[model samples]
Target: MTLLLLLDDPAQPGVVELQSLTDDGLPEGSVSVAADDLASAVREREADRPRWVWDDTSRRYPPLLAAGVRVERCHDLRLCHAILRRSVYSQSSTLAGAPPGPWDGPREPPPVEGSLFDDVGPSVVADPLAELREQLAAVAGADEPGRLRLLLAAESTGALIAAEMQRDGMPWSVETHDALLVSLLGERPRSGRPPKLEALADEVRAALGQPSLNLDSQPDLLRGLRAAGCDVESTRTWEIKALEHPVRDPLLAYKKLSRLLSANGWAWMEAWVHDGRFRPDYVPGGVVTGRWATSGGGALQLPASIRAAVRADPGWKLVVADAAQLEPRVLAAMSGDTAMAAAGRKADLYQGVVDAGIVETRSEAKYAMLGAIYGATTGPSAVLMPRLTRAYPHAVALVEAGARAGERGDVVSTWLGRTSPRPDAAWQAEHAAASAEGAGADDVRAARRRGRDWGRFTRNFIVQGTAAEWALCWMASLRRRLLELDGRPHLVFFLHDEVMVHAPAEVADEVAVAMRSSAVEAGRLLFGATPVEFALNVAVVDSYDQAK
Candidate 1:
């Protein structure tokens, strides 16, 4: 008997038919169709041509759609044939996706819930803009145009905060900002020197209606001044004194602290800015595998007091973007473990793995899996290994093999050129000697020696070093793309895995698009035909912490 299946227009959507033919060459199921069913039927009665017909018992039918349409009998046969064809002809699936198109609108970050600024008391919130305007007016009233020291001071503080935020992944919360202000102005002794400082103090004290004050106790004074506006508290115990001050009223003290901190931050920033502008230096080839490095001035650090000065240049704004969960995604693609890859494609890879029955819980799966790949042994891995071994035997086996090789003191290399160096001769000798011992106490020695012989260290070097290369390429690509934009925004800061550019405000959106495009490009450049992808977060702000 022969079986035949017919499908609708291969080029368009339609129906399917199945047929079976008896050994005697008679159609056994349904009506029999001629070899050229569509052509013959059309010739006899053009309008009555049947789209599909079949004999289920004999399993024979006329061709539907085109002859090139796929044909098979049993389900297994079809699947096997499809797999073979794909394996032979399809390109490797590790390539990155296409670059993003030009941005059409603003790419502002969504408002963060529970920002650092939330800690600031209600006084500033009552009318922050009004308070700022009033303070600006008072300082402007005392000084001539261009010589407005208070404005300069505020600008400087903003710059410092921006720098610090870039360096550390810290939050720019209100409490931290207040603490930074206190730290900056806490202990400047009143030297009656720097005439501008003394003059500024007098003006501020007058504004707050207080007696001449000692600036050394600036934190206490700042508290009192904020209290006058109905917001005051000693958030930092180290800055407070139990004894009442005899020199200045609390309001004057607070005013002095706020002014001094703002002013001092400005002065420090002025010194840090080389030549004329506060252009921070960036290190492109910083990490071992291609990540960034930090040079002089800790350009990445943005202490809160200094962030206010990081205002967008007049008519320009800052736009920032960062990747989300990049490393695990890379791992999922590299291993080609279908189960792991499927889990990753759905959502957070680590969390997905836990839900997919890979481990008892999310934390256990993450710790064990990450530990296995990253060579984390003593801590979380100890608790995580058994579950991982049970769930992902193939993926875990690869890592275990690498770990064993590392113990044996062998070198391992990634697809790229980076390599983990081989172990020293002393370690090799111990393994060799242990191999010669017989079973007993000597057996323990042999086991320990064999453990060391496996390439545990080398395995990690291969994975981490390669991962670093990917990060480097990602940063490099982003830097190049940013440079290509119309305006020549300076590439001011880089930490391993992140790049910070200072560009004009109008082109901020363009810069963000460039960043996204560059990440995709970098992935393609490194992985070639392998399937790879990326996600990014963008923000516009005066400081790095706010960028998050």
Candidate 2:
């Protein structure tokens, strides 16, 4: 079933306009509901499991959730429109050829309830029925319509999940957070730096023999280090650690502490966490490769130092599952490399690589595999590349082909047809200059370097992008399974390849099974009949830190 939903008109106050469409998108009928009865209407229609087509999932779903109404599926028009606009598979579609308008902008930050229809531009009032027909036609007319349809479905489901996770929020313990902060960084001060950070700063200045040095100023600190005989180009942590100096340890400590203070400190808690929950504003499909990014609250980059503050409710446990070697396994399956797939059949893919005699140690295997996918051309990775290529020729060839295509300024698509963006006009001009009849040596070398850099980006894009697609499938499957379980298990947090489900202690085991089975289901969905295994390390714990 398909339902077209329009935002309620401001003049109409509580009335919502809706139309039902047949499978082929012909309108069957139209209906209107008052704001007070909107949830009931949606709930009644959910019995048929309709795929509600709306302007934006993030904007529309939250109000439904607030009213305790959860739909089974949806088609997020705005998100799908963005995908079809740039996807190579849909280049011939009318949507792709149309001029930019309301649909081309970044998703507006979710609006507050009651004013949901407020501040919306032309997109809210524009004919969504016409927009829906255009999007459906775009997908149906694509070179590989099935793959593009799957990508759109998965991406839209992700938008719903993002909103639900935000509404449910992560279970946070502010008391524990404060205590951890105090233990690492001294008691909160009225104004200045905490005692521990201040002490570390003093130690750094003393070790450099420059008492008046302003450590926060990069130029001043670099000058001080050079004056004290430490020849380093930058104040990066790795560069400082490589230097042999007494100031190294204190400076590193100071930086770590400073990051904690500024990034996740007491001020952060006050702003983001409220009433025992930390809700982050997640931007779905924010990354070019389809990885999620947080618009606020730094959810994607939650530091290990503060994870201890994430605690479950009294009777619930946190079921945390991280996909093991996700990208490598994805590459193996997508490339159909029998050797690589066989190597990943076990829990430890790197060890499997070592047992195959492809590398000397597990570390070398990791470096070689990552190097192959990411186009590493120097260091241990470069040294180990030949052996890997000899062992898994197909996997190596897949990414190598992508790199070659990128060097020629061509775009590449993922397994499910999400295409990489082409190099911009500036890059094209530079390459053109180098190829001119009288091009200089420097210009030629510069263009070659630029090409190699872009090549590296494309080399990883196919694998990383497909890996992201696999993750979306995994999460979508797990979401449905979680709903079937007896306990009210809900997803609380999600990283790139990790998910944490909060469930009753008895159902934690069920959640673990769901997580594992979802990986299998996701694999079948992406690469049917492939031998590669997507394994996960599942842990049931009371707190987030204990999951490891």
Which candidate should be chosen as best, given TM-score against the real structure? 2
Clash number for each model? 60, 1
Tens digits of per-residue lDDT for model 1, 1-548:
24222222222222222233232223345333333343343233323322221111011111211222211111111111111111211112111011321111111221122221122112212222232233234333432322223122222222222233332222223433334544545434445334444555665456555656444474755655564453336524233333233223443454444554444443444445533245333332233332334444454555444565444555556566665456655554556555665665544667777788867677777787777777666887877777776766655666666777677665555434333445567666766666664636675576575664455555555556555556545655565475578775544444444555667777777887887787777566556554445556667665555675
Give RMSD (Å) of candidate 2 vs. truth.
Answer: 1.6
lDDT (C-alpha) at residue 525 in model 2: 90
lDDT of 1: 0.45
Off-target runs (Cα >4 Å) in candidate 1 are: 1-181, 188-292, 295-312, 354-365, 378-380, 389-394, 429-456
Which segments of model 2 are wrong by more than 4 Å?
A: 8-14, 113-125
Instruction: Work out the TM-score per prediction.
Output: 0.47, 0.97
TM-score of 2: 0.97
lDDT of each: 0.45, 0.89
Q: Find the candidate with the highest lDDT and give its number.
A: 2
lDDT string, candidate 2, 367-464, tens digits = 99999999999999999999999999999999999999999899988898888888999999999999999999999999999999999999899999
lDDT of 2 at 273: 99
